[model samples]
Target: MPESDPLQPGSPESDALFELEPRAAETVGFAQLARLPLTELVAPDWAEALAPVEDALREVLAFLAAEAADGHEVLPPPSYLLRAFRQPLAGVRVLIVGQDPYPTPGHAVGLSFAVDGRTRPIPRSLANIYKELDADLGLAPRIHGDLGRWAEQGVLLLNRVMSVRSGAARSHRNRGWEAITAAAISAVADRRTADGGPTPFVAILWGRDAWSVRALLGTAPVIASAHPSPLSASRGFFGSRPFSQANALLQAQGNGTVDWELPPLP
Candidate 1:
């Protein structure tokens, strides 16, 4: 689809899309979606709003369940699947969509490009992201890769496909996660203030995979950049200034700017 005009903060066009239908399945109650340990994966607040798309969520869980049944190992562990939504949904001020979890052991921790703890030798793509972050904000990069701070600051560090087979990248590419995450994106876009005021978010879409979901972000301002891989970082990601640009957009939308700083390494 060709790019449309940038969505105004509270334009009706954007609000209309906020009534998110399941992108790949029918809406149904959680009873039919199985009483799986979904709460263990997604935060309670988000799980309640996501109940409308229980069918798609069910498909995602079923896929993972089947994969586990077949003895296939999934990355980021099971409980961290919806770690992206650990913060309040209404607090989300920005969304960064990644393609999938890192395939390397001890690398995937639900949040995109983030590891479980302060680990050395972060993924190359994440290293590139650090470089861009420094260039964009004139701050020194930290040694650790846990981005939970960004999530707590209202940045939804979501991966379109949340998991992968251990050691195998893109192993779960064609599964139903795309639909489930897409619906989640729309849900965030539709979020309003407690008084029913407009509360738009900024979307930083990196790489082709992330850009593929740009259309679902409603009227939120979008900043697009090439993938932060060494192969492409210099081409566009280096100068993208996504962190600064996202803050600018958030301010323009009448929201508070995000403090993009990561915590210091212990």
Candidate 2:
């Protein structure tokens, strides 16, 4: 069953607003992440987990606001920042971390490498990912690039730095997002079952950037591989079978496997 929204309208959860933009935000509650505008769109569980890095989040947001004020084009519109958390944190059955948001203007929807469609040519890394997905899941590739379905099924499709300046990849790397997300990584790692064991969620760490969070993942099953970038894909990503492997691990842990076959886009 789909989980009930804890941030329903008119409830106290909706009243807790930590506004990132001057305009009205969503009806969603920020939970413990109420202090950081960057995480305000996340689920209550994720927000609460992010509480420890509130100060780091604040610093990051302030810097972003300042950058915007300086006339820089920050990609992945603010409204899409928390799309990855739409399914809520507690429901997270898988975690896939990317390095940063796409540098192209319309290429990023805030869920890390996912574009709006699978047109003529997409990012090299994304194309590589699709190739691997096809090989691992034994499913024909769809032309669309939207990965929101994966996110809806409890995949935390997060990026190390959630946003980047238009045409400038890794522009926000040195900003405070690393610290804030590091804390998030730690919190997710800390999630424990009734028997005090690691949760069933599987972590797929691609490349060094994503692997950096490995230390914080505790005992969660990890499927580490070379990045699905043209530069490194041939080295390891091509035959990694991460999608199948991740689902296999989840099943071994007594959890439902993810349906990696994405549906066609309208």
Candidate 3:
């Protein structure tokens, strides 16, 4: 179920994203990391759990920053990279993992399969998502591709690999992003809500890349289907009804349903 291209970056081609050995952060100290970009960008909600991997995350960001400083264009404008974590962890009821940020400039809003509200002619993959949403729940497709409303309702729309070089899809894979996101996904699967005997949760895994984390979910209900990309949606994604199935899983655990509705702008 991997993406169309799976060579990934950690191979000898791009060098490992994390190497704190002779060439790594041995000399760097707490006081030094205190001033790095990681402290400024990592949301407080995720700070403590992700602390152990802080150095690796910083290294990943440094690589991206270095790429930008070298005049390469990075998508989602940096600020949006961690936007998915703005919601409290306890509030999250659903997890959706996208392969990576959209390669087209301005098309990736940090959330998987989502774009900025003003983006025109939504990406075909996203359009297919809306089509499935309609078929599954009788919901109308939004004119704008912004999925922020879903995030507000406890839907974590995360990209397994968050950043990418403009016009190059999956160019950042195996570049240390996988390690960071894997921790985040595992944390979500393990969380137990305060005062709740059992918390309800659902994961919508659309493709091989997304399904790769299925083992980490530890029995968390999953709705697996083909990726919604125009290339593969017809194969299995269209009739899967993942949206309805997800709600049923959540309700089975006595939790509230996700508000999948995306109303058009006024």
Candidate 4:
């Protein structure tokens, strides 16, 4: 099956709302493109090529917007942000597809999730996973540097639901967000490859909600593991090994090792 309700809650209303948004029409059209910061946005080539599928994008956005208007409190409409981040989709080899944005204020910036290395603590499971991997791989310091190094090799960090506005925090809303995330990933996966080839993308699903969307990935080769939170650790989701596993898979597929460049924490 194609993974039901990638958004949290997966309610009928929420889905309907996502279907109504005019993201596609707006993205290609001048008005919508003008709203975004050209420098920060993803380039236009990929999005332009996908213009034929604008209706689908619009539908998803409409459904999301309606849900928010109906008090589902979804994340901010990320269509503009999505367009800005379009560059990665062109030929991205690995995508770390997360669930929704973080619940904390000012963390979700359309496409990026902020994990404050100096302030907000790293999730314990994530920390443990990194520590374990570092130990096994003979890498020391057990810090963000290791993960940062992995990012340089063309690993694109993406959340399923990209934008959650500040002050909109609800468990149910988060569930709805998950559904939106799933829908977004589906959208990207549907894009035709640059050379008219298969879209060879690897997705890393971290956490429980992320894991739940496995069906959406189809045969795209996914890495399903614990959420990297303290809560997940209680359930026995320990391993520094998953990183190595991910690396090995990428190498086997000829994706090569990640660059490990530290992403701006988040």
For model 3, where is the 10-residue window of minimal lDDT?
A: 1-10
lDDT (10s digit) by residue, model 1, range 103-158? 88667877887886646777889888888888889777888888878888888899
Query: The CA-based lDDT of model 2 is what?
Result: 0.74
lDDT of 1 at 94: 88
Tens-digit lDDT string for candidate 2 (146-227): 8878887888888988879889989899887888778777777788889977778899999999998998898888999999
Give the per-residue Cα lDDT of candidate 3 at 22: 21
Candidate 4 local distance difference test against the native: 0.49
Native RMSD of candidate 3 (Å): 10.4
Better of 2 and 3 by lDDT: 3
Best by lDDT: 3
> How many steric overlaps are in each model, in order?
0, 0, 1, 48
Between candidates 3 and 4, the one scoring higher on TM-score is 3
Stretches > 4 Å off in candidate 4? 1-41, 45-86, 109-113, 116-129, 136-152, 165-180, 187-199, 234-236, 261-266
C-alpha TM-score for every candidate: 0.82, 0.84, 0.84, 0.59
Let me know the TM-score candidate 3 reaches against the reference structure. 0.84
What are the runs in model 2 whose C-alpha is more than 4 Å off?
1-40, 118-120
